[model samples]
Target chain A: MNAKTSSPIPPAEWIVAGMGLLVFTAVLGLMVWDAVAGDQSPPRITVEVDSITRSGDGHLLKFRARNDGGETAAEVVVEGELPASGGETETASATLDFLPAHSERKGGFFFKAQPERETVRLRASSFREP
Target chain B: MVRRGPKTLMSRRASATHKPAPRGTSRHFLRALARAFAGAIVFGLPLLMTMEMWWLGFHADRGRMALLFILSLPLLVGLSHYSGFEPTFGWVDDVVDTFVACAVGFVSSGVILLLFGLIEPGMAASEVIGKIGLQTLPASIGALLATGQFASPEEREADQKRFRKYQGELFLMMVGAIFLALSMAPTDEMMLIAYMMTPTHVLGLIFLSLVVMHAFVHAVESSGKAYVPSGTPFWSVFLRITIPGYVIALLISALILWAFERTDSCGPATLMGSVIVLGFPAAIGAGASRLII
Candidate 1:
């Protein structure tokens, strides 16, 4: 078996092996990077009730922020605000019973946003899929 | 283009028999049926899934083919058990599977729903990631832990190369599954509609399929040389890569579904009747992949 058949395998074979090995490393590196950089597991939703308010015209609202989710939703606890849109904010308790457990609930609060007072845009994080 | 098996395939005459027989009893018939069925499922499902997405996208405001296919994929696992071809490997197949699965999975995993939830309002990226993390971390950790120690490292590393390929395939399947879900979701921002669907019953079925199929695919093939084929082009790549992805996606979907169930949702179906009907094919056929073992 001289140079014709296979005296010895060509150095290119080693090159091919090296290339394959390189590709594996690169992919593994990428997977590891993704696992670290991304690695976001999932998401849980929890809601909090911040403030209960009563407006001047007569409406109620409960302020809330979510602990681990997107929206900081407000529920109507007292429901006296103007049907069109006018109200006040007040602090209160007993709003807990108003919300159904194991569910996201909305309620009217005693608080109202004065159309005049700079508009308080409620901000929150985006909702990521679970 | 190329379509489902037996019906339009070269061996239509034999496939017409539709009888299940041992290898030699009717070798050509079974092979034909397998090829035809394989052709239908491999080419057909994707096409159908793609069409559904297209329909949704065109007909509705927000339609995604990949997401729809990914999400609806569980339905196929049950169906596929009845079909005759399985996914195996060639480089091209692996690549396609990965891309398709990733695109679809990301969309279905509530990504669309999150967008809708915020479209009414708006949410920041950090808030989104953070919120998602909070919801997912505990669950992910619990799952990773509960799955417990692999009874064998010899098992995982048994065929590292094959295992990696298998993992990659499974990942693609997950993406495909989610795409299926997203595609089905009507584009309009109806939180009520999407959420109503998310109640875990429908989602649970998808997850369960993923788990059973994934466990089978991985456990069996993970331990041996994956069925890598000779030189290939289109079909080889298409089939090789996507099949494993399909299996893995099945499992990932299940985990996602299970998580949804755990947190808060509708009542779990307490009946063996419904669960059994749904679960049998996926469990048994996926288990058959142990043939690879």
Candidate 2:
């Protein structure tokens, strides 16, 4: 211990230090509870269209990808498909960097053909374990 | 055990000139807190910007995170003992400084994450807490080190004098190892590099790490901030400091890897390889800490 201080500590400084103690205790408590009892379910991803809007040459399909489980999903690929008149399906895909457990990420796909709400099919194609 | 140095004399003279009122004391604390914020940003920016760090925040093993958090209190206390934002007189001051550093770490991390858009509105509380909490330890250490990093030469000498004991030296090495390891351990590249290397490469890397660590220690010693007393045998210094320092680095690397969940899926061989890969930087950090701190 280097004993150099001679002045008494200010009350305001002590109050701030007390607040810091509270923050540390709360975070420590949360971490302990999470470690002992929190869920560890694998990622369960669900993709849904949020809105369809027009871009320059194509319509942009904005979608939300939600992770409903307790693990994070990475490189999440979502696909949107629309059935064409010629019987071929028009497919557009988007990738999200990460969808943390119990969290949502927003992404968009572009399609030249306008997609109807009922006919547009959106699905989370795949996700890598993170 | 009090070593009266120039710093003490300077402080005494200053106090004699003007008695420090409560307002002055509070203002001094505020300045230290500001320095802590700057230190947190300087040391924590890389991890704050790293993508793997963000992902690990949510998915990392909670038990390990808790353990890391628990370990950080003592680490910060020890660091505060050496070079806190301000000089501390006792254990109570050291503990108070530790918490204040943590508070600075948390606030700095939160504000930066928000500015970067990593923490968005309506985000899960757990995710936000996880990200901020995971970053807090390293940033707190940085906060504790602000004074050492920015001190006047005389003040730095005084601080360094307090850590001349063997235990104190080793503790500083551990802090250095953890600081560097925390920044590098969360990356996928550690695994990828380990996977790409053959056994011969691993052996080569092990030899290189030891040589580099020893070289750093030797350089520091020759520069006159000598940890090795004069007339000490070469092999004795090597055995006493360099070897143990390297071992501490390796252990820290392994611990950090486990904390980041990088070892969860790997086999023993891969795990060992990853540890060695990370150990290189940790060794450098350990060796260089003597010079830096």
lDDT per residue, candidate 1, B115-154, as tens digits?
4352123233333332322222112111111101211222
**Candidate 2 colliding pairs:** none
Alpha-carbon local distance difference test for all models: 0.32, 0.83
lDDT of 1 by residue, A1-130 (tens): 1332222222432333344334333333433343355323332334344444556785444445333322222231222222224354433332322111112433333434332113332322334222
| lDDT of each residue in A53-85, candidate 2, tens digit only | 999999988888888888878898999999878
**Count of clashes in candidate 2:** 0
DockQ, per model, reads 0.03, 0.58
Model 2 chain B — which ten-residue stretch has the worst lDDT? B15-24
TM per candidate comes to: 0.27, 0.89
